[model samples]
Target: MENDVLRNIALSYSPMIDRNRAVVATRLTVSALRTGGPLQADQLLAAIAEVWPEGGTRVSLNVMSETLLNDLLRAKPLSNVMIEIPSFIACDPVNTDAILQLQGNTLLLHGRPPSMLPRELLPRFKYSIVDLADDRRRNEVAGQAEAAGVTRSVGFVQSGVRTTAEMEASFGRGAVAILGWPIEDVVSQSGGRAGQPDMAVLVELIRRVDDAEDVDKLDAVLKRDPTLAFQLLRYINSPAFGLSVEISSFRHAIMLLGYKRLKRWLALLLATASKDVNMRPVMFASVRRGLFMEQLVANSGDEEMRGEVFICGVFSLLDRLFNKPFDELLKTIPVPERVYQALVESAGPYHPYLELTKAVETETAPVINEYAETLLMSLLEVNRAVLGTLTMAAQLE
Candidate 1:
């Protein structure tokens, strides 16, 4: 089939764990059809399956034509699929009756106030995507959802930008899930302060680890913090590592991971020390990006280039991690110019790898295809790499 429709496809994840406590619901946004357009059902379903291989994708069809809408409503493909319709459709008694007849199907109401949804039909769907963008509007809708006894959730589809405090507030106001906005982007940098003893030690340790080639020195430095040592040991021994025999000693860890991988882990450890809920999704994204980049390089028969690209992928989010400018932070660390240029200027050789990695995250199929072709890859290759990265990330989590 032609891949035209897939070009406008983008995936947004639910930031919070769902009611059933699933990891996250990957929401598929059909940008082309969002504003109303002609889309064949086959192409549309294929695109959804491609992005969300596992079922349970949340899709909103506010702009779909009545014919296509009724087709999906009749078929009832997957119970895991949450079908969202606008208030205009729900206001129709016949349409509402037909939707409620679907066996155990989940529904969401969008494009109207929660108060506008018929009270009789409120129990048919699972939750409402409340537009809590403004302070006054948020409080109002939140109360409406509350009175209707519907779970309140806000999506950043229209909201400009939300802060960590605001997300926490929404969660407090009974937001079961947050859509679109990345929580990491809005977290305050006040979590870090200059000249603080613990902060200084972590920074110093990251710097020292980057410079350390001596095994004894590396082991001693890691031993300085029992918590760090334990975390490292736990990670290396996890099933994700796939070690035939468990590694029990620092010497074994050094032998297995090597100095380069060791330093990379230390950097990531420092980057992810915060227990902030917002940071988890960002960290996962960073790790997934790095894995995606590393896999691409690995397939290109560039053995030595693997580590550099992996580092590029992993540390690409230092700006968010340390809550400082990447270049300013790079000054304190000893990253090679190749990695720095790729990250900061996007002009280096490895820069294409980083760009392709990001393209996998947010770009359309045509754009991703162009990047893949430039990298001597096919769509199948990119898809396999993405699957590998997602699998690895799940294990690490």
Candidate 2:
């Protein structure tokens, strides 16, 4: 569908985290739509399904036109998509008529409750997307919900949240979910002083894998840390792995994955072996970066280079992951010169891929365009890598 008048579509997603900090659903925004014109409903829905096949996808329609949106809503098959509409569009006569026509499709999303939304329009929207900053300006949670707290609104997802305090305050007010995690806030406090997967057992397992030892031997190492063993199982069992039956043992998971893919997965998983629960978002980003960078070079590189590039992407954030400088961390774990060069020195062939991955993550259209142009890759090619990585990474979760 590349030539279907759609070009350079870039997607950025925010995990809709529950109170427990686990992702319940994903909020997706089409940061950049087709260069030709507004995207069609079928194309957009198809793209969402392709990227997030497991469902629990909330498609934000802020970039869509009211006419196209109404058309899509009327004809779209997936009634389960949580459509988030802006205040201006939701109240529009054309869109409202289409929404009301469906009758059962009352799950329209908009600003915080008691927002500019007219009193009569309240019942139509069961979900609220509150910008924490703006909401605080009007109805301050500062004094209202103190230590003990007051009654908070349920089912509203707070956006514009970027700090630990803001997240706590948002939840302190009873928000059902948070739109996105404060990864930057957490990482800032960490300030590169992070944990590592250099645990004795993990190091041994890495050695065993590198030495081409039997899977059973590796299993022995994993048994030392049941959590590590479980993570291996979960990652291998992830939908992206495409195993027919469940793998109850680390040895079995490792055997099916063989050596090459296992090496790549292990490289990404090692960085995420930290016990700090707050690093979930960072870990998530790390894994996706690895996948995104790997996919970006899939068409151009050899098998071994692809794996190294993948490691390069995962290890780029090694400073923030291992609680140490790049030189210090790389000294412990054996990495290729290129991977080290890209991560520590940030000057290598893979460095441009790393830079492009960051730009794509931020969903900055012009910057992404610049990187794509510099890399001499078509926007369509770059976007495919972006969407493909997002889809695979989501499956890993």
Candidate 3:
């Protein structure tokens, strides 16, 4: 995946946006080789300051090589950037004092084993970032850090962190700040050539328009999955729908939303249901994207456009969903030209809406405002839709 896409996904699920935590994670992407050019610490600090204005933003600098380390140390902090240094820095006894000098400005130790921490340095190391690869290791490290008179902020650096359970577990372990990748399905599911039954349900729903004409088949399918039916009713009756009367049954829902709208809701269901826990965040984000786009399109009073935008939002993660390249996957599914443009090339008339969806994911003020102006939508409207979408996801669960 592209770095920007990965960053967007990571940021979408991150609790840092809530701003309740004392320590915040600050991510950095830099190469140690200096293949592109010299590391511009000034520019890097400026960007971090803008996104993480809070004084407690904890930055994890991925040190690639010794050369990169030297460059970073030379650059002075302009915006109170508290740099975190690995405990391994003390391995070299020659530069121990120099490294300690940088301590007051940032944390001296970054989640290392107690054995690795030098005895002399223990008295100097007041604050640390703890390593939390697993429960046993986390407890051992946290206990060790505490004994040394060091307080810690923790995180999980290992890969394959995909579910709500995993995320919450890390935080429960006393991680004031945690860091993980963009949350995608790292583990492939077992099962067959045609994919899972739940996925097939989505395909069948799309292919069968007869259900719209004859509500009996649609009702039968809903009957087969009572959970799906209940969720659909709950969604239609939600405050976002602004319905005075509640939707009580599948047939009633079909009558109100029609076959086309019903198909879209089923598509949304397919996106949310994933056998692999890693895909949960991606799926949640996809549903939110669709709902956001639908709100933007509804404002224009264009019924057809609203449907297309929803499709665009829901199916945006097909490549990640199937673990296949997007271009190859698009050939198998039959979507409108507008959706193809928005998901693939990111061009055409619907492209602007997709752009707005992306901006919402990033939650950056400048980017969100820019897209809002392009769609003639107020930032307030966009924010409300985002909050509504998140609420909708929780209710669906």
Clashes of each: 0, 3, 0
Every candidate's lDDT = 0.59, 0.68, 0.57
Quote the positional error of residue 145 for candidate 3 in Å.
3.5
Displacement of residue 368 (Cα, Å) in model 1 is 4.8
The residue pairs in collision within model 2 are 193-323, 194-322, 194-323
Q: In what order do the candidates fall by TM-score, top score first?
A: 2, 1, 3
Best by lDDT: 2
Q: Please say which candidate is ahead in TM-score: 1 or 3.
A: 1
Candidate number with the higher TM-score (2 or 3): 2
Name the weakest run of 10 consecutive residues (lDDT summed) in model 2: 54-63
Residue 98 local lDDT, model 2: 57
Which parts of model 1 are misplaced by more than 4 Å? 1-14, 17-106, 113-121, 131-136, 139-162, 172-174, 181-189, 193-212, 276-278, 356-380
Compose the digit string of candidate 2's lDDT tens values, residues 14-109.
566767767666665554544566556787667666665434454444343555556566655354466776777666555565555454343646
lDDT of 3 at 223: 72
lDDT of 3 by residue, 166-192 (tens): 555555555444444334433343121
TM-score against native, each model: 0.69, 0.81, 0.55
